[model samples]
Target: MNFGPPLTTRETPAQRAQGELILGFKRLGAVTKIDTLFQQGALKARLPRPQDPTLCEAVTLNISGGVAGGDALDTMVTLAPGAQLALASQAAERIYRTPGPAARIRTRLIVQEGARLDYLPQETILFDRFALDRELDIDLQGDAEFVGVETLLFGRQAMGEIVQSGSLRDRIRLRHDGRLVFQDATRLEGGIAAQLQRRTVADGARAVAGLIIAGPEAAHKLDSLRAVLNAAPGIVAGASAFDNMIFARLLAPDGASLRQCLISALEACRERRKLPRVWQG
Candidate 1:
């Protein structure tokens, strides 16, 4: 067996490449109908199996493959009257290290008259030195309803790795019948993660998750919902109902605890609204 050029432990000469990706969807129907599509790097939308045909629940979307580094993902979802939709990732969204520039994710949602939609995706975990910017824009009709949740973790806490480096920026805007309801932006850098770990700041927290629930019954569930929030363990959570919508917020050290709190709060709200738990697991 002949060996190649003097096996050097360190190789030299390198090449770099860059690319972009986008994923989108739209709904079309008068009463309980949906149309969807997606396009991304090495990812495509597959036809979902029909289940419980009579229910007015929205179509479910799952990201089967992980979003790779150096790949940008953009998604647009629309819902029509009497129709609803839900979107989620099959697993946690991983932001890998990129040799080029920062990765991006942008999502736009439109809800038509008397429709409902839920945009509950999986948690996003950022590795060391991973850079990402995400923006979410939501538009709802006057009588439409929308619920969404986003969970963010700085790094893999199980490895005892602290998010000492990296950058995460997120922006969100919600509009109801052309009326703005919520706007939030977070830019973390320059030891911000360490500052968040402080009790005075985030109370030794490592994860943050929030829920935006808006609809007709959102006005009367604050008291009962707050009671449920007070009972969840290992979480600091609260619920507020006013202005025809209810919002719930949760902060925890990990994703499991935060998800539990969200599930409980969701169930409580569903009960309060006399509606079935539409969250399909």
Candidate 2:
């Protein structure tokens, strides 16, 4: 029972034998330009129905055949000074079961001075034997602000399966004015989930998401942020300021909870930074 309409289809069999879809967006001064680029696509995608669509917008990328190794989706988003943009996926990104290949998605975001970028995509779930490679890069000016949250689920819980198979190679990099600020390169393989839960990365949590907020006032709002996170239920989260950036982390059991926590955290930061409440439904 797929609750909604059949997850929007992409292309026909004859047309999809090529590669997957690729959606792209570029923003300049509050306006967005989209390019639905596909390797060999035939089906069309529709708009997402988000709980609070006004806060975020989604444009279909490429929808070709099923995901496979060497398949890639490249996107570039640029913001002008004094402009702001919020972006999210239409739905939880799904990685279908594949034999030996992996789906790859690369996203690059650029925030100019005095501009802001908020990217809150839904969770990414990997089915058994599924392989995926994801890369996210952010380039920021000293005064630019950026917020991005990504949640990864190991396996399909409903099927009573665990993430014992396949591999995920994930990378994250953030730079400010040509200086490296933060970088994380991690690989998850056999029995890695158990190790991740022991004491380090995520502590065995089924879902995890990170929020990065950078701007002028990020350093002054640490105390208030602590209080807000303390109020969330069944959540282990933290906030800190470094190199003119304020970042937060939240670990939970699933994607919905993480998104709620993200909304709360964003609201707290907005209040302290005197920015508008962009998550309001």
Candidate 3:
């Protein structure tokens, strides 16, 4: 019998994507305007109607919809002296399953003297086997106020998807007046679900959130924030006040509960401004 010709298989090359966005705002008279803007690849910025005349709002958009392996994004925001700006995302960022390399994200925020900046992006949803690495760096000058919030969902509980294995590395660094004021780093890999179930880890929580408020009045609001967290039911939350910064962390069994707890905590901290419209919808 004659043997058939040898068969061969061809492997497809991995697809890699990269994007960068740079935005700057300046104060002119009583209004803040975009003085510098740059966008490339899949990242873009959208200016929104400001509810406050002195505040400029910017919404970021990821045209690629979601991120997977070998994908990277970089964003930079600068606020001129005396300018005020609020930065948010158009929608929740999604991290898809990765075969190997982890998706990466880097964000840098610079606030000048007497300026104010609020970074309030929506939640980040991670799928099974997804891998992501993210870093946020904030620099503030004299008397600059900065507030930021971050939320993470391990998997879509509504869809019955649970994250059993994956990798996540997140870091946040803040410097005020050339001195480091805050630093937080978290890493989870391999059996994510099992790790989250550990009492010392997440205590079986599916969702987690963190908030940072750094300014003159941060210390004064600690007691109020603690009270709010104590009153919230079905959520594990706590807050601490440092020299000039206040930090809060929350954990819940589901995303909805986590979001409600976060909102309540923010309200207690005197963040009365309405969240971005995208967050509400």
Candidate 4:
């Protein structure tokens, strides 16, 4: 083996996108409002006119358009006692193809006592030759509540795009009252299209989603959530609860079907509450 000069192209600081965003909210009288917010680089947060004073709504935007290898984004959200917040992305995030290095995304969510939070970012579409690694960590203090979802798609099947080769590593961890309640991790590499078609995998599904509801009363709604998942058409979904946490997974034949099922399931998780405006339109 020779340790000569390496010859591999990589994204430079000027060519790669780097972003960091932090948002904090607290309850003031009857309304939960933004306490502190910080954004840098290609990430931004926009607050729409509040329809419900008790729940503050926010939408996140990616200024650099989409994601590519060597790109990095860091996001953190915190809620103080008695505060409520609903957060969503402006639209679906697409991961474009990269040369070698994989793009990275990290998110941290903190909910203090008596606070409630909904983190409902839209789906992520992965194109061919893409590489992505993402992680989400949620820390819930005493009696804090959290509802979140993540959706992933292999490619735009309608556009004749197929994920013939790619790599994705996704992980989520939830801790309630300082104790770990739920965790899920997925790793896929090489010939993903063929891999997803296996009988035990997705059964030819083109899209997939994961939803989690965590709170003191979360487990009680498992039955209803399961019912909603079962009734939805064009998707195969299931739900399970452990302690105060409820977890569900859905697989669909296309993005449109996934969105419909997801919207219904989200409404059920939110107890008939309306989703963020960005999701509706």
Relative to the true structure, how large is the alpha-carbon lDDT of every model?
0.66, 0.65, 0.89, 0.92
Candidate 4 residues lying further than 4 Å off, grouped into runs, are: 1-14
- Tens digit of per-residue lDDT, candidate 4, span 45-103: 99998777778999999999999999999999999999999999999999999876999
Task: List TM-scores for all candidates, in order.
Answer: 0.78, 0.74, 0.94, 0.94
Candidate 4 has which clashing residue pairs, if any?
none
Q: What is the lDDT of residue 7 in candidate 2?
A: 69
1-281: candidate 2 lDDT, tens digit per residue: 45776668775532112333344434443454443434334223343443332222444334543455556666666666655556655455666656655777777787788766777666677776777788989898869877777777766565665665677888989999989898867687756457557657778777677777767777777777778788888888887788877777778766556667767776777653322232343
Which residue runs of candidate 2 sit more than 4 Å off their true CA positions? 1-68, 156-161, 271-281
Which portions of model 3 show Cα errors greater than 4 Å?
1-9
**True-structure RMSD, every candidate:** 5.1, 9.4, 1.9, 4.7
lDDT for model 2, please. 0.65
RMSD in angstroms between candidate 2 and the native structure over all alpha carbons? 9.4
Query: Using lDDT as the measure, what is the rank order of every candidate, best first?
Result: 4, 3, 1, 2
Tell me the deviation in Å of residue 87 in model 4: 0.3
CA lDDT for candidate 3: 0.89
lDDT of 2 at 62: 42
TM-score preference between candidates 1 and 2, better one: 1
Clashing pairs in 2: 10-43, 11-43, 21-62, 21-63, 22-62, 23-61, 69-102, 197-204
